[model samples]
Target: MTATTPPAVSMLAPARPRRPRAARVLLAAACAAVFLWPVVMVAVGAFRTSLPGTPGGWTVTKLVDTYLSPVTYQVLAQTVFFAVSVTVVSTLLALFFAWVVARTDTPLRRLVTPMMGLVLAMPPLFFAISWGMLGNQRVGLLNTVYQWLTGAGHGFFNVESWFGLILVSSLKAASFSYFLLLGPFLTMDRSLEEASLTAGAGRARTFFRVQLPLLTPAISGAAFLTMLAFLEAFDIPEIIGIPAGIRVLPTQIYSHINATYGGQYAEASSLAMCLMLIILALVAVRARLLGGREFTTVSGKSYRLERWKLGRARWLGTGGILGYGLLALVLPLAQLYLGSLQSLFGRYDGFSLDNYAAVLDDAEITGAIRDTALLAVLGGLVTVVVCTGLAAVLRTRGGLAERLVTISVWMPMALPGIVLGLGIMWSFLSVPGLNQLYATIWILLVGLFIGAVPVGMRAAEGALAQIPRDLEEAARIGGASRVRAFAGVVVPLIVPSLLSGWLLVAIMISGNLAIPVLLASPTSQTVSVEVLKLYQSGEISQAAAVFCVISTAMAAVGVVVGVVRAVLSRRTLLRGTG
Candidate 1:
């Protein structure tokens, strides 16, 4: 009789909900629209007869006319050459320094790490301005010092030349590659190199035959990323190349946008399309090189990093590193600090606090400081949240949907900031209701959000990959909903990574000039834009003063982040020990 009744159903049984495919699809589409709409608008504008504000229809006149021009070809060629030169030099320099620091017992190796961090902390625009001040032929501090030491009538170094441009750009580019390569160099399996050495290979042979071959993936990846970075970079070429009468694609696009008589927005869009195509081609090649290969260097095993003892040559390595720091960090910072105190840029005409006082007192500068703070904080927060969600979906849901989301999020990394700015300008101005935001700080925030999402997403994805899904699943099994499980188990674990991504985006937005330059109204001006304007107007002392303020603020933020990181790391260590 009891068996015939069929046991009472248990109301506490766990329920497994199906994945929300439609919602994920909708999210993917929404993200794609947010990220890709601007670029699509630029493409549409490029073929149009006039700018967004003007009355015109679609036409290929601008594209055909631009392609037919000889200057366009020249500029394109120069841009490729410049990018390639910087990539090669920077990658090689980074490889050398990374090797010295990670593999060898180089003196001051620990110091070199923090020095590189400082170098990265300094903005590229700041580098451009500082070097411009230091290497000016007439009144540059470096030139003056060189003249003083060598008794030369004319200055030996001119930052306005192509050589100077390449040097500064390579220095900046090297920092990026250095950071990228350092991780690989540090965690690489020493067993492979040891095997090579045990098999009768000398040190050089081991490096070339075994070590370098194993690192081909990292090296090539770094090189390609550096190339992409150089192609998108506008600060170096804009500040140094303009004065030297040297034109590249990015600078050419900028010139078209800022022409005396109302400028050519359509033409700028056309040029941006060309630049975008070139970048797409590079990306295709990079993809082909990276695909269908196993570049894994680590496994589920413990390993020790064998550091080479370079007793005598340690000093030589130390000297080379310090020399690089002198050029890349010490010299520029020293010049910037000294320039800030001077009444004039090059002349140390009896140092005074006047420039700092003037810069601090200016309403525009003060406003810029406040606006940049808001942009950094708000933009960074929005980007981190959005990118974290996108990354989580992409990581957990691997399929066509995930791939689409990944591509959409990363698309902005390929576009130059100025190009992105131009696209946003067109997108907002062409839209009926969105046009109201064209000159507002909101546009800048949105543009920066788009620009920074890739970085934040990548960081988040890496952090998420390290965490196990079992933790969330266990919570789900213990009668918790999916969202509750994720919130309770995942977010707390990834807080450090989230903080890192936020800090990175904040730093990037604070220093970014290209996005703000075109999008900002007078009321929305940022420190980067103001610094550029001041430098362009020949107010070198005032610009230097502003740069000092910005740099100091950035350094303070960096210090705070460093301290927090250290504290968190100690806590993590204690937890591990306990």
Candidate 2:
């Protein structure tokens, strides 16, 4: 008898080959191309003397000229200066707080820990307005307080400088690093510290040698993420730096797109392209540096974490958290209230609720807030859905889908907001019959979805992979189809993760400045864009109030979502075990 495979076995293999690999590849590519359409357009426009009318007939001379500009060189120098300052300050601050919470026996670690995460969710515009309310030379509330305290004159505190920009960005951005470092510090094996102690190493020495080395991957990742944030910052630099005559690449790009002289689309496109290239280089360097490090901070091994007794320093840690929180959170909101109560800002004679009334009265104010909320919720939901699909494709074995999704995550992240906006304008707005989206709020929504999908998808994909395959198999054995098994068994398991992704996208969309700045029509402005308008027009108090409302609303939503999620999770676990 011939040793050939059975006809039934061969038939089974071809009938339903896993996921139709080609379809998966095609979906991944189509998704990637949708995201990349803007990026490709930007590259072409950046090199052309004028915006490209045809995709095939673009020129590279604009990019060449952009490199030759002395202003471009200066912008590069300023960008590096601000980025380095923010990185150093944020990393050190994050490291200090992380150590206090994770290693020391502090009185309020639980409260402080989640608060740090909350701070991380605050939009940069809020940070800028808060600082502006307290530090701006002409209208600073804190300057008034300082004069009262020290008998000093007003206009002494200038927030529109390079130092001010760096400090503000760092203070706000540090919370991300703190969140990143907290888990690693909590999960690290305490035995390493004990071994170092046995070798006669002191607490400080053990930290430098044993603990820091193990936390290297986490630190590197946190720093790189913060660096990217500092690099791409827009609203803070726009509001504060413009007044101070300090400009970074993002603000510079904004100027080219929206400032007085009919838009300098070519120069803006060039700057955006340069920013993307710089981001790519930084990410590449980080990946290379972290390649050799072991990233297994949380393994299956369980070890009791030893907490250091911080008897006296406990108060110090508590005080530090309180002070940072007040600086970033409390003080800003207070200043906003004081500012918004004034009928005419900078006038001490009259105190009234006219500013708040005025805010309610303005048609633009109401419209912007409504638009911002609707777009944020819609964009967040779409991001969660699309990202889940992308993540699923990525979790499977090596193939075109996996490779494309991985590349998509890293690539668009490098694309600057201004450049992405410009690309969208070209591909969707400039094209014949496509400019209709530009008229509707949907254009901004599309930009928000594209901007945040990669982030949401990555988070969802990671969460989805942790679900045990046995659950799905058991469902399948009960006569369920693959789709049914996923729907019945997998969806419920990953809902919490899905919600987290949605919350992130919502926060991002609410805080987003670039796309809305470029895409929002007068009728479709967002709160961030309104705040920017007020900032640009030098209406400090009104801007501060708007900033406070938007930021505070986001933080409140985050708290509500977190609480509901916790309650739901407990009920779910109880039901599963029952």
Q: Tell me the tens digit of each residue's lDDT in model 1 across 1-578.
A: 36575554443446668578898788779878888988998888888776676677887877888988999999988899999999999999899899998999998888877888878878899999889988899889888988889999988889999999999999888888999899999988888778788999998998888777778889998999888888878998999988998888888888998897778877888889999999999889888977898866664565778899988988999898988999999899888899999887777769999999999899999999999999999999998888777776776668777777888888999999989988888888888888988788999999988988888888788878878998887898798987798878788777777888889889988999888888999888899999999999999889989988877787788789878877776775676479
Name the top TM-score candidate: 1
Residue-pair clashes per candidate: 0, 0
TM per model?
0.93, 0.90
Worst window of 10 by summed lDDT in candidate 2: 8-17
Error in Å for residue 330 of model 2: 1.9
* Candidate 1 C-alpha error for residue 345, in Å: 1.1
Stretches of candidate 1 off by over 4 Å are 1-13, 194-200, 295-304, 561-578
State, as a TM-score between 0 and 1, how close model 1 is to the true structure. 0.93
